[model samples]
Target: MSLDGHTAVPPESSIPPMPGFPPRAGIPTQHAAPPGGTPGFDVTGWVSAKRHRTPPAIFSLGPEPRPSDPKTLADDAIPGWKLILRAALNFLVALEIFMWLTGGALVWALGFVWPALIKAAGQEEFWATTLLNLLYVPVALILVFVFGRMGRWKAVWRRYGSPAWSRLRGVAVPTAGPVRGPVEPVDVWGPLRVVADPGTLALLDAETAQGLVGDVDHQRLLGALERVRQEPERLAALLGAVREHGAVACAHPSGARDLPGRSLAHDLLSRQLRLGAAENVPKNPAGYRGADIALDPLLLGTSLLAVGPAGSGKTTRLTRPVAEALCLQALTGSAVVVVVGAADADLGPAAWYDVVVAPGDPQAGYGLDLFGGAAHADEAAARLADALLPDELALRTESARLALQQIVGPFESGYGRLPGVRELVLLLRGEEQAWAGLLAAVRGSGMLDRHQHELAQRERMHGLADDPGTLLADRLALLDRPVFAGCFNPSAGDRAPLPLFALRALDHPLRVRIALPDHSHPEAARILARLAVGQFLHAAASRADRSLFAGLVVDDASAAVDTHAVRGLQRLRAANAGAVLGLRTLVDLPESLRAPLFGAVGGRMAFPGLAPWDGKLFEEAWGTVWVDERDVTRSLDTSGGVVRRSFRGMRALLEGERAQTESVTTRKVERRRWSASDLAQVLPRGHAVVSLTSVDGTQVPPLLVRLP
Candidate 1:
């Protein structure tokens, strides 16, 4: 099976050659709009000859099957069609001899028209030929001009013009002019050769045809070649017969004959979250625009989702470019980034960031403050409780919440700040009080109610005194790892302290990296990521000024659920912050969280590797799309159970009344403007069906964007 999941047909999968070409069914076509066009792909042998496959030899076709010796047709009793036709041909041969002699008598038989034949041959004069050429030139011009007005010109040429003729002849038509223009530049990825039949060519507008004609990057070059509902017939009619590079296109077009790549850095709009200009920039189907990474400064408040399986190139194509662009922004002092990714993931231009926290990096000494910013004791306790607990620990939420409030209140009452994670861990363990001030503050400031409250829960919690702490301790173990030694508790280790909320106050632009080693301790990484995000949200919520732009990025979000996920996903907009959350599959999210989490993000990218259920999410996300449907019926005539279709086909039929098996078939067929299953499992690599909310709140349809 190829990338599109069809083993039978290749590109030009849909509108197969109007009735007389090779069979191609259930193939994929590039119909772009986007939010992007589906990038070109061929996992099967249809686009090109497969090296491992040897096509069967054609032994029974053409006129070569004619001939039989008729000595019983072939020297013996084994008879054939020749045995029956030989006698019939004998009489025809006699009649042919009589007519052969009559051919020379054509001049005598039509003496009256002899002069007319000679006149056409130019036997009259050179003057006569010259006169006709001059007169006919003017007459032919007039005839062409008159016919051009009727639409007959367009309709007729659609069937017989360059595009159509090229298809009919089974060859690609050269697009360059006969006379040379300036030398054309070549693209680095090399040239792409596409062979599309005329019907497919008919559906393409000139600009699009030009993009397909030129050699560009796979993302930009092939993305512009997508076909949609308006040209369903033409899309299916086209076939990509020749493929030598990463891209493929139409074999013929009626419009712009040459396609050229655009310059991204200089020609693009010079503002927020912009990447490269779109391929064939002006998107058709009107309102479905392209380019502009859809990462608006105002809208980052809503968020983004980039998903695909490992090796699907989400990092290279989608993540990398966006990261580099954001890095550039950070360098300009406009935004702050808190990016958490796999340890080895490359974030461009390291100098742009002020902080880099790599787990297991002993020398860096970085860990979030854990409870850095809280308006009061209750809020801090609530946030900590949520972050430290998981859904599996349902019984612990309220108890842990009450216990955390007790722990933080005493620490804050004494030290004037919330306790660090390491301190919280020790206090939960009931260790001897190392800080005499905590004991002193608790006893002296105790109003009668405070003392009674602390004692009341002690007996009620006695039986489960260590349960909640132990469970949370396991998840927080990474904080004490050698890499984060000095970072977790300022007093516990001799190294410099690194804090999560420290950057929230920075007036200048800053880049922050939180490295999670997915390749090694994925679970630990996930838990840490969740804690950091929850802290960031708390920090964002308390800001006196929400003017500063901030982004929190989590790659592989499906791995774990942090405390702030629900509010952070849906309500971060008020904090003037946006998030980019990456997930491999939606199934990883709990059922209760899935719906709201999806609804919260204003922009989405559904890449390959999603299951049908996942694809259905996109369908719902994209909502309904109106598509053109064609019902095709195919019939197979079986003569004596041997299927055949020809003038003499009746000869093979069983003569008597008989029972026979039925032979015929027919059938029926979203946001990628395809079925959900196709978008989920069959979407080619490095591509996504994107639905983004424009600044105006216009809900654009999901568009195919070949990732760059």
Candidate 2:
């Protein structure tokens, strides 16, 4: 099957423009807001396209506004029919009044002049009647303008004319002067010519294009173009494959356009993926409501924290679209994305990813390297220990890591490679012969301390009840089950083993999906998730190239979140990397980590049905914004003679409100952007409250969003 789960055709017959994958019904396709219009408003969509510009291509983001178009004005101040009705009503009223004022005089004058006009013209009544009918047209028009609101046409056109026309055209049209020229072509190199479409070409500067073509490191250049299309992000790999196979030519396996997956919007030009629409709520900025709520690397680079109860659409609404966008960006040669979730989670189709690491599944395409492909045994041990040790064993973690290092280091030194899970577990168990063999190997390899004191110390610890090696062995044995026999064994199987360490030196965009076996092995899955997180952090920080955006999306990050992962998240922004972590609630984590995790991520989202405590984290993270506070006071009017008071009481009884003095006060004061209660209870189903911070320091205050 193709990357998008479509049936894959043979390479020879795959080059065809296929129909778009039919999306599930009732899910609205997202479109860019017509220039000068709100997100959901598109006059062009409502009108005839034949009279305007051509319909946009499937991947195009429709048209943008021109210089002459009114930027702040939207189309049609009033409905066209309503405007006409108003104008016609005014004309009829004016005509009735005119007749009323003229009364019998107008009729008398016309009757008196009828014969005189006929005699002067020397024509029949029919001819005279025709002449009068012709004169009425201009007179009626004059009356309509004088009395009717028909003059509003000028003002309406003045405000909405340019935008309405531009939206209809699908391209900006100049109000004055000759039409704009066609987009210039970029002169680039031969290799890049294969995939550069006209629109993509137009975006390229000649000098930059030339520079990129001449770049000695084609792989590096490919990485730089991630998120922006030049050629398929896999061009370098394709070239290498062709050279290795000595093939004369190769056709695109998946055709020009990416195979369709589930997504509401993919606006590559703006680098934003629309998730939903910002609801028109009081908490949201007036301008933001009805505008597309989207995600891009800029906002995602600071990391995103999503909290929602089960079935709140965290997976369906947020993770799916975000992962799809990153996958599409990866296709453009612009970004690398790693998506983690339960095996059955509908993150995306396996065909969309470069590697699908489904642990516990025998047929999984890739095996996860337990050591994260680390060359240093100590580095591998630290990462593995983090995954193996539970939060309750925080104090035991250091000793466990040390215990793992002792075994892993000696095994690597003796065998010249990292040990698989079973091998590490066997060493950790301190079996008589296994321990003796490892000690002999270490001594033979000269890895032992002078006088063999280190080996002696290890021996002494292994016989004690408090030895951390036993605990470490028990934890590592979780994955040694028959179900995971071939998994995490990079050197044992013919299957490809994916290592997070390779992410640091990537030349082209790589998409990886790690499906944790959540059902059958929940604990093991969490360990794997923690392993992935720890390695991803190390790789992102050590990356040699920062041009391509690196992203991770964890569909359920409950037990996977720990202190180390939180710290890693805080550093992702500076590394040009980010993560999207979804959680059921803050209570899933340790109470102490909740506030710190909130502080670590720059973006936070609270979905409908969130717990109050989870909502509180979002509330604190968003802080407060200034709003106008209004106060009104009413005092009874009771100062007069007895008869006056009785008269006021009678008036109050009749009016339903007592006569009173009123005082009003308005002041600016601080208020939480979104109170905890609002986030928990007031949020509507299929909606979420989200706040975002871009890498460049732009902040989008918390706003309620209606999911697409």
| RMSD vs true structure, all candidates | 21.1, 12.1
What TM-score would candidate 2 get against the native?
Answer: 0.67
RMSD of 1: 21.1
The residue ranges of model 1 lying beyond 4 angstroms of the native Cα positions read 1-294, 433-437, 444-467, 492-503, 506-508, 519-521, 560-563, 631-674
Tell me how many clashing residue pairs each candidate has.
18, 6
Q: Can you write out model 2's per-residue Cα lDDT over 599-677, one digit (the tens) per residue?
A: 8898899999988877777777888989889798999988999999998885554333588988999999999988889
Question: Poorest 10 consecutive residues of model 1 by lDDT?
Answer: 53-62
Residue 215, candidate 1: alpha-carbon lDDT: 19
Q: In model 1, what lDDT does residue 89 have? A: 40
How well is each residue in 283-312 modelled by candidate 1, as lDDT tens digits?
A: 112222223233445545667787667776
**Best-fitting candidate, scored by TM-score:** 2
